[model samples]
Target: MTVLVAISLTTGILSGIWGWVAVSLGLLSWAGFLGCTTYFASPKDGIRGLGLSIVTNMSGVFWAMVIIHLSSLFSVEILGYVVTALVSFFMCVQAKKTWLNYIPGTFIGSCATFAANGDWQLVIPSLIVGALFGYTMKASGLWLHQKLNQPNSKLAAAEAE
Candidate 1:
């Protein structure tokens, strides 16, 4: 809970000068999405479901925007697509059995944007981007999980602190 609060404050501060509204909505949606997904996806109110879901957003949205906009002098759209793919992939990696669980966040945002702009051309592109980023997120998350679970790594040390 404390960590979540800290993340919220951090996100709030960072979003304040940028797309505050988008970030705020993204945060709330992410939380609700996390909770609902966990609730429905898990057989019991287990820690894995809840924890994984929370971690997905703890840094997910921020990174999505960060990678998309901060990576290079390339177009913002390229970054957006790359970020989306990477994040999505990482999500799959973290919760190996629940690959589909990670798609809602990406799909929702993509569909909404396409709908608003009535951009049929964007629909396919958005889906591809979402899948790529989603996979990256899953892979990275699972890697983090593995490294953290190691007996005597920095991740274990940090956990003991």
Candidate 2:
């Protein structure tokens, strides 16, 4: 099968398994999926992509926390919006750092954190595990593709027969 097909199948199977495991462990499955999406969306592949996804996602979480705390200080309500806007600007600007260059990953992380209601404890682990899942899926997919395409593999042998 094609590499794309292999990757798709691997991702689909692992995602279902991740959902089950996350729920069983009392973790946030959605956040894990977001982390997985971040991994695939990363500009780089392999370990570099993994690192970039994690760092950017964490940075997003940090910014979201800052927005949550700083906005809480004011009762103006509108100030919350203002603080969010300001913090969002900072989030975009922070992309100057190479590790945080993945803007979408950061946004995804921030959204996940917000959804978790600032519970970084749950969000952080879930994201990390999800990113790991993404990496594993890709690696497994490539391995499967290689095995299928090998010249002397069972498929090839059967075809020759």
Candidate 3:
């Protein structure tokens, strides 16, 4: 609980600055997207999930956007399902082949932007930012977890003094 709170406060501050940069550059970082995805994807497996989520976001978003653009040519409403199916399929295959089933985070992360923007070009850069932010949070969480778990030997000693 303490670990989670610390991460929230820290990332909140960091994200405020990052959001400013995104606003200045007219680029959407979507840092919270990665944090939520990571939290839900692997609550127990911290470091490993963090690494896999990064890969998933990078590859999944790019391929999903590609499929979205191609499907646009069909000019059909059901094409949305087709695009989602294709993207999900590709991510699943990658997960199986790489032995990292967590790769679904990539698809999960991309789905929103794909539906809203459908701009294939932003896929690469946007997912990259997502992955990086996910990594940052996971690493911080892991660090906090360790610190919190540590025996309070120092505190005990200070209290004795």
Candidate 4:
């Protein structure tokens, strides 16, 4: 959809500007895709979804950091994996009950954070920028939808077909 496209483009632009922030362009695209899925699920709840997604994403980063630190201290790879698996299972269950609508964005954002291997401080701003872009895209899409649905527009004629 046009909204997703806009979100992706905006995210890319933000990523370029904050190149040192550690959130890769690929991650931004993933975030945009998540935003699209959330929008599809509930257009009116897009903003709330974005907010929850950001919080959940940062929580994931914190979780990863804790695991990584403990693994380093203990020098046990399996320990880290076990903890991650356990946490993931519980988180998914809770996600369904609490942040059901924002799950996609939250999950993808966390994945991106882990993949980037970036700093926690940087992750906050990066995710915030991504979320803002998604909201902007939604606004643009609404405008486009309005214009396209206008009685005098060619889109109206196409819609009649």
| Candidate of highest lDDT | 2
Model 2 lDDT, residue 80, Cα: 99
Count backbone overlaps in model 3. 0
TM-score of 1: 0.31
Q: List the lowest-lDDT window of 10 residues for candidate 1.
A: 124-133
Model 4 Cα displacement at 13 (Å)?
A: 9.5
What is the model-wide C-alpha lDDT for candidate 4? 0.56
Q: Which one is best on TM-score?
A: 2
Candidate 2 worst ten-residue window by lDDT: 148-157
Q: lDDT, candidate 2, residue 130? A: 97
Off by over 4 Å in 1: 1-34, 71-73, 76-80, 94-161
lDDT of 2 by residue, 35-142 (tens): 999999899999999999999999989999999999999999999999999999999999998888899999998999999999999999999999999998998999
Q: Write the per-residue lDDT of candidate 3 for residues 41-133, one digit (tens) a residue.
A: 653465566656656655656676777677877878798678768767877777665535665566655674565476545545555565556
* Pairs of residues at least 3 apart in sequence or in different chains that clash in candidate 2: none
Backbone clashes for every candidate come to 26, 0, 0, 0
Question: What lDDT tens digits, residue by residue, belong to model 1 across residues 40-76?
Answer: 3433233453444333333344344444344454665
Could you give candidate 4's per-residue lDDT for residues 21-61 as a string of tens digits? 33454344444444344343432445675666666665666
